[model samples]
Target: MTVDPELLIHRDADDLAFSVAARMITAITDAQSTGGVAEVVLTGGRVAARIYRAVAESPARVEVDWQRVEFWWGDERFLPPGNPERNETQARDALLAHVDVDPARVHPMPADTGQSAEAAADAYATELAATISALNDEKRRAVPAFDVLMLGVGPDGHVASLFPGYPQLAVTDVSAVAVHDSPKPPPTRVSLTLPALDRSREVWFVVSGDDKADAVATALAEGDVPAARPKGRNRTLWLLDEAAASKLT
Candidate 1:
């Protein structure tokens, strides 16, 4: 059952990030209120980093039990663990460091370990499988339908390192993959494939800036782009600011 994407426009980047932080708090508290821990897959970008900071500063953040929430990344730059450019590092610095999240539940994609990218991907795959198994006792699957999966729409219509027209977008067998020679900087990365990313109850694309306007329009249009193909099981959301939504009709 494919659900159409829901477009949400905020005044600007700051407002969009703040709104997303509030929504995230609501989702987490709602799940916790139902006596279940919520799992969220986070993306990286300027807007995402801002969202994290907003979350950390939001007074409503205390409504959710941070320790009960599980954090995962949609993709990560395969750099050293503490590299400032790494998504995990940015996330921690922006929000996680201030939150009381359990260290055990924070699952970051593998970084430099003197192993091949494929080997690192395999290691993360194993870890994800175990996490899903422990989370879903009945299904014991490789992936879990996470409560919320946030993605940052790139200027090139890419999501989770899945570039437009890239062969990695054709992948279906694995939940995660190792990207090499990426068109963007820091060529190597670890990314959750569409299959894994799509395994979410709600998927949110947070985008900002006029530079991403065309890409946002393309994604919202009935297109075959990889960014448009991945949707959530229950809901697909496009959270954009004025600039990013400018090109959308």
Candidate 2:
């Protein structure tokens, strides 16, 4: 089903990043107050890098207990653990390194070390299941309903690592899957399937740049783009810069 996303446009990338960072802090704080802990799924991109930097510098960073906020990635590049291009490495340098988050709660998808992408994906799924089970005493949750699941909308209208027309997007039972022949460089990745993304209470698509305008517009319109398909259980938000929102009607 195509759920209409709530649109939020900022004047520029800088503005968009800072606003998203602030909103994330607020969401984490709110969740911590009620749930004792909060879970958030992170994404990586140029805009996401900026958002992480903003979060690292924000004054409100101290308002929430970083240790109580669990961090997970939406997708991960199948490369060595320390590879700069890897989302986990970038996220650590951008924000995690600076924050006092619990290392135990920061779950990153397994990186390729000559291991098959499918193996890495299965490992991640098991990790997710274990974490959710440990945290929730009331119910046996295979996938936890994240307080916020942030995604970077690719130029090709992909979310996480699920590209348009990709078979991974059609996967329903699995919470995560392996992308073996992604059109994007690196080709291999482990990503949360649409089923996992939709498990979130809120999903935020943070997109910027004129290059992404068409994808943003197509996602908002009645289309079959993978970016258009995923929706949050409670809220699906599009956080775009003016350039990215230019083509939206």
Candidate 3:
């Protein structure tokens, strides 16, 4: 385990992405060496977008057996297909679309926005349950263990849909959840619950901005304050650029 959030302070966005790309490459190789296959859960945000693009451009990324990998989303905007705000759409354009991973393995959150968030939540859970059942050796309802999970920390200390002061963050029973009234923009969305997210062997929270500096300090200050500073946890990482790390004390 890392003593701190694996701080990687870079001078600019490009340097940040390169560092993230390298770390991600290491994660992919580690997963492959251990399980012969890798299952990754991806997140969204400005920092993540850069990392996604960098991974796409990385020459070393081709070393992984893309065909043997599966992809999942941590959160998704409840928007129409191809909507600019949708995380899935962004990932498709940024990374997945360029990769050779089988189309069947890319699991985006259910896009039943026309339906109620509750209904969409159930449907998303069902889809993941079916996939997990098929993938697990012990006939589980959830994926045995996600190889890696990448996330973006909202300034409000939200990770995925586990937003601060939100009731859903305390959700202990469900693996996936649907969110309404998001404190951020585009109110309706779906997300993996904290339980679901922590199932991953490795979790990464990448942030890069001056605005996020305070949150970074809180999250790393040593307390189980996911709602206050979602960065607290084990087997997790916070990859930050110099701007985001500036206020850490």
lDDT for every model?
A: 0.88, 0.89, 0.76
- In model 2, the Cα lDDT at residue 85 comes to 96
Q: What is the lDDT of candidate 2?
A: 0.89
Q: Which numbered prediction scores highest in lDDT against the true structure?
A: 2
Higher-TM-score candidate of 1 and 2: 1
Provide the global lDDT of candidate 3 against the true structure: 0.76
With a 3 Å backbone cut-off (N, CA, C), the pairs that clash in candidate 2 are: none
Superposed Cα RMSD, model 3: 2.9
Which of 2 and 3 is the better model by TM-score?
2
How far residue 54's Cα lies from its native spot in candidate 2, in Å, is 0.5
Model 3 regions lying over 4 Å from their true place: 1-5, 138-143, 223-234
| Candidate 3 lDDT over residue span 1-249, tens digit each | 223446556886678878988888788888778556677888888877888899888898888788877889888888888887889888899998888888888888877547777777777778877777677854342436677888877676677887777788878887777788987789988888877776776677777888888777777775444623332234667678888889887
lDDT of 1 by residue, 68-154 (tens): 898999998998879998899989999999999999999999888688778888888888887887888844445478889999888
